[model samples]
Target: MKKLSALICIIAILPFSLKAQRTQKPPLHGKHWMAITGKPLAATAGAGIFQKGGNAVDAACAMLAATCTMWDVLSWGGETQALIYNPHTKKVIAINALGVAPSGATPEFFKNKGYNFPPEYGPLAAVTPGTPGGLCLMLARYGSLSLEEVLAPAMEMAAGYPIEAQTANSIERNKKRISQWPYSKKVFLVHQGEKREAPEAGEIFVQKDLLATLQKLVDTEQAALKAGKSREEAIMAACDRFYKGDIAAEIARGCQEQGGLITKEDLANWKPVIEEPLHINYRGIEVYKLQPWTQGPSMLQSLNILEQFDLKSMGYNSPEYIHTVYQAMNLAFADRDFYYGDPAFSPTIPVKGLLSKGYAKERAALIQPGKNLANAAPGNPYPYEDRQQPFQKLLDIREQWVENPGKDKPGSFVPKHDATYHSENKNEMGWATTKDLAVDSLYMDRLWRGTTSIEAADEEGWVVSVTPSGGWVPACIAGNTGVGMSQRMQSFVLDSILDPYNVVAPGKRPRVTLTPSMALKDGLPYLSFAVQGGDTQDQNLLQFFLNMVEFNMTVQQAAEAANFNSNQLWLSLGGTQVKDRQPRPGSLLLNRSTPDATRSSLEKMGYSLQFGDRTSGPINAIYLDRKHGSIWGGSSNNGEDYGIGW
Candidate 1:
């Protein structure tokens, strides 16, 4: 009778527990909130900002600063881009923080010299940097906190802290390149406030020059606003202080001296263009992404194609399921390579035709059952052929000089000599679709592309989403900032991803794979988001969309549950190449942080696993639940520490 009574009582409470778990309110104290990234402190810093009355935009800005200070592998002074949705305005917005080539740049210049326009890390590599300008724009337009308030934590942290394990690893790995830059040595190598080199993790690494730069922005803004400048005027003043004024001139002069293409004109003319985001409808949910400059649109294309199938019945992580998705990824990736590019620059690009529903159907027909469409002909290969002429010559010779990438050689930056990348597989096979392949069995994709940060705001009925990124890194490292700008040539990889036949010519903005995405359902804002990790961004995002809309998973569950990876990239060092019946590359599997039942289940489903620190990129999102009067914010704890506030 006692056991029966206890069982009855447990049954009575089941509904309540289910309800609580499903609809529990957020910002709950004592609940273990999680975030993933390369640095623990930075993730903590991002979450802390969210806890401190900062919204998503504020949290992102805070995280960006922390990343700059801590994750020296990539951070501030680098490029960023994002897509945001505002419920109030009923629209999505985009911010382009991508850099541009100098006015003096021309394809002929490189051809005449018998060399690539920008030698990797060459002085002529600097492009117009837009990170600071874009960050300020988001804050000034939407954030309630002052720049000083938002940047305060970074300022304090930058004052003292040792180099982290990740930073030390990146520095040591890239030591050869670091040695080439005097500024990098002055800031990162030498100990803070001491002449000796800082030791590995726990030794203080300070960016005094960066702090000084932040201080100038704050002081100048305060003075300008106190002088009765309008908010817009004051913001512009601050931006100019960073871009066109003394700061801009100094950067421009350094770039010029370094043999970079950026000039005073590039900086002066450079501005973050607020453009309308490209959007598509998938199963009644509206999806918005940045236009051709990045891979976001390609993701949408894959989702649209997949919408034609019933993924739920296929079951989670099954081989058939994974194969179907891989096929979609490969198809979209092929289109991205052949047709996507900057609309303003690549005349052959078919942005309108590619995204059309009619076109999506045509592309979908190419996926055959039970076999691979490996090395298939492009969807519309003609338009791209003319544009890709100059870069094709380089591709023919790439096999002779490009060294294959390997995990053991993670420290090896770019290939310097001819080596068979496809034959020499150094990376793990991304997904379980193919067996009998080891790391050296597959080719390498250049890891340098897609240095990005995403941000969004939903304030005062206004919305903004922006993504900032560029083609290459360390265009020049600033000693004071401890940051490197990107040297993005209007080149082949970015364009080829969108339009394979398109020739990579000079002065063209390559089809960007850096896409920021937003979603709306039932005439209301549903989510604001973006994906990072180069080719992996699109693949992960496609799964995310299916989980939420097709399978009816909650946003958090859809994003968090998977063992994620991508194979859409080229088999070459920088592109994705798919062999017949061979699996794609870049799998982002969600392994058990603490091994148990989940691990066993995932392994049974054929996951080739590796452990990564909590800070994974590829996500950060917030949802506005109007009925609940609360904002649902979460970050992917799988990698980077990402968060949502307000």
Candidate 2:
């Protein structure tokens, strides 16, 4: 009788146990519009724009401006990469606002400085500013509002705004570096010579120069409009002022004074290109990402490979599932590190071949069933594109490097912004032996390097997803423009051995990790999403998409899901030495909540595991609920990412 009662008790608890747990934050529901971003105030800016009778593109521009002003891991001088879904055309378009290496940024220039890659910070690392022009182009082309209207929120914030703790603390912690540039020191060091030289949390940090600069753009636009220019022409006039007028003169002067390479010619020559995004069909859903210049296509490749597997049967977060995902990512990233680069440059990338399902299958076939493939090298995609392999010798050299990564000279890898953005505790550095801990910390820093994402959508079917980055804290403020210079030049490789396609060159965009994602089902917008980690952006995004599709989790649940990261790919940011960019094959980061059995199985499969409480992302996403005639918004609980829907 007692045994029967116990069985009944177990049966009674089963239903509740099987039910999904309540999320820490509720999903945002909206019928008219939804706006989500890295910072709460930035999302509020988007919401304000939405309420003011703006479309998704206008709202997104406002949010981008606000976030850049607020220094949400980016500034006005940073690059802006976006994927926008236009309801009118029923098409998705990509915006490539990535900055280019300035006039003297050749490989020999950096190699002569005794650096393997570009320096991690300072004026020397700056590329020509892209955000300003990109924002203007986006607003002028598709937006319903004027530049003044879209920039109002950001201009207000630029005049004066309460600084958040994260940015304030970052400024304080890196004050020594900030003090190196006179303009930067003037703007960021509000409490110079004090125990804390940066603005306190909640302090009203003012940037008078920045405000003046924004005012100049608005004034230029208004002047152009008064002169009978069309809205688009007026916006372009303001953009031209920044690139070719007095503003350009000041920027060039400032950059040169600070020992940077950006010239007025570089700025004037640069323009944001609207290109067709690359995509692959996974099951019935078509997903889109920026071209090879970004690491976006790697996720598509991973999805194509995983489509062949019975992922649902393997179960979510299971050892087999994680291993399979990891191996697929490894294979895709291997191609990314080798073949992905600015398409406008020489030695054309075999992108057609790389995105081929046949190519994915061939790569997927290399995955070991019971062990990690530690030496996964780049595969031949040229054949798939009907082209001959011209770099067979380079591929052989890459294979040798994969087998012996330690052949490169090892140096100390110090990631200055890790503490400021991620809030990593230095005390946790004691988790392993000093040497192992240093490697782990460096890998973690590279994996979780900072950026910010923006997602916005409207009832009219317009959607915008953006991943804008660079010019984080410890940034060098260029002249008196109050705009921090972009440190994106560091992502370039100084040697062909590191990345032949991404070798630093004048007028070439560095292959960046920033990527925005969008999905379409049956010729309609299904999901718009993005995240903010450097190398880990696509890794986290891949799992987030899978969580919603295969596992049938809510957008919010997927954003907060327990996803694992593979450290078996090249680092895109941080480190001045080649060793810092080398892959740490078999290293994996798993959520602390992972089952012990799964952990043991992964360990036995030759994986070196590391645990983290929050392993997934601060991913922001919007799912169009076509059936419900509403939008479902998801912002991860990991950070201050917030969304407003109404």
Candidate 3:
């Protein structure tokens, strides 16, 4: 009788527990369309496009433009990586609009400057702007609306919008850097010499130059259309004006004047590539991500490794589950640190072997059951590709490189501001620091670097997911064009021993952390999702997906759920010195609400744990509810990310 009473009590509380887990935010429901992004106003922009009878592509472009205009941790000069699902073709398409290094960016050039890697900021850390051409290309080829129509919201914002505290405060905080560049100083320091140079929270901030530049593109497109050009032709004309015409000339002049290396020829020659994405079948769903040029494939690789385990049996957020997921992420990230890079360059990256199921099985076998795999190393995917490893010597010496990065290098280049910045922001950044862990507030800034994601879906079945970033605050304004140059150059390595495939070279794209994701079920769009964290992007996304598939959480629950991050991989950004990029093995970030038992277990497993109120994401996602003939949208509760559906 006692056992029966206890069982009844436990069963009574189960539904309430489940209800609490799913009630953090209400799930957005839509019958016709759904628009979700980093900001509420940006989502409204997307909704306006959808209301104008535009498809998912048009809405996504509008949101991208609006987010860039609002400086949602990105700008007009950033790079864009997207994955689109075409209902008609029943296929996922990849957009690689990442910018390339300019003529003077070479390994020897940076080494000569006494740099271990590229500098973290300024004109010297820039790549050719890719966002303008990319947005144009995506809008021209896949969208139904005109470029002018899609860019309307962004143009309005650029004219003058009430700036939010986040962006306004960021500008104020970095005023010294902004004041360094004449054009930036002129544009951003509206209240120069005031107590706060940047505009206050609700002040109307105007970008007359950006407004004029956008008007020029629209004017050029209109002219082309009046000349009997087709819709695509007219859009291409605007693209050409930006890259090859007078707009390009102004950008080049301003960049060079600011000590940037982007030349007119580089701008003219660069073009966004449309390519097939990579995928892996997990259970019945197919997940798609951009090629190796991004850190996206690592998520797919993790999925493959995790597939071999019965994750549901471990329970959600259980000690065993967290340990398993962390180990898998570490394994996948180890390969990303060494093997992943721009496939367009190099002795080709062995992506096929890396994504192969056989290779994943081999990697999965390396995970220890009772402890953290702190020293996870890259596996030999060469044999899986039926090819001998050409860089075996480098592979053998990989540990030594990690242990003593740039050991043989001659010079040091540590900026004085970095130390001061880290010291001041250490307690406020929300990351725990310890003697055993070398991570500081500055490292956390790079680790969780901001970006904005766009997810849109229409009833007709078009789905778009984008993670676009770069040209953030304290950005150097290129010229009269009012565009910031890309700081993507910092993502590249100067030494082949660090990453041979990603060594700095003119015309090469760097291995970036931006990744957008899409999953298909039964030949239909299942989920379109993305997030805005730097190295933590794929890690957060992996958990988000699993939360839905294995744990049966609604899209909103998954978006708001607690997720952990493994700092056992190389830092992708803000590492001016070799030591800065080194991985912090066994370091894990857990949600503050994590159970005490889970923490104790992880600690016993040789893990160094840190806690945060919100460890996972501000992920934005859209789920196609084919069974109900509707859509579900999820915008995380972590930040300014918001969504609208109708």
C-alpha local distance difference test of each model? 0.53, 0.84, 0.84
lDDT of 3: 0.84
Ranked candidates, highest lDDT first: 2, 3, 1
Candidate 2 stretches with Cα past 4 Å from truth are 1-21, 405-416, 419-449
| TM-score of decoy 3 | 0.92
Q: Is candidate 2 or candidate 3 better by lDDT?
A: 2
| Per-model TM values vs. the true structure | 0.74, 0.93, 0.92
Residue 238 lDDT in candidate 1: 76
Best candidate according to lDDT: 2
Local error of candidate 2 at 619, Å? 0.3
In terms of lDDT, model 1 sits at 0.53
* Residue pair clashes in candidate 3: none
lDDT of 3 by residue, 1-646 (tens): 1221221100011334447555456778887888888877788888888878899999999999999988887889889999989888888999999999999999888888888889878888888888988899889989999999999999999999999877887798899999989988888899998999999998999998888889999999999999999999999999999999988998889989988899999999999999999999999999999998999999999999999899999998898899899999999998898888888886479899999999999999998886887779888899998999888899778777665554332111112222112222222223334322343554334333378899999988899999999888888888998887788899899877777788889999999999999999998899999998778889999999999999998998898889988878877887677766667677787887888888889888877676655655878899888889998988776677778787
lDDT of 2 by residue, 1-646 (tens): 1221221100011234434655667677888889999887888888888877899999999999998898887898899999999988999999999989999999899989989889989888999989998899888998999989989998999888999887787688679888989999999999888898899999998999889998999999999999999999999999999889888888888889989989999999999899999999999999999999999999999998998899999999999999999999999998889888999875488889999999988998998897898888888998998999888998888777666665463222223344212223322322232113322443333334368899999988899999998888788888889898899998899877667889999999999999999999999999999998778889999999999999999987898788888878878877787776667677787787888899889879978666665776778999999899999888776677888887
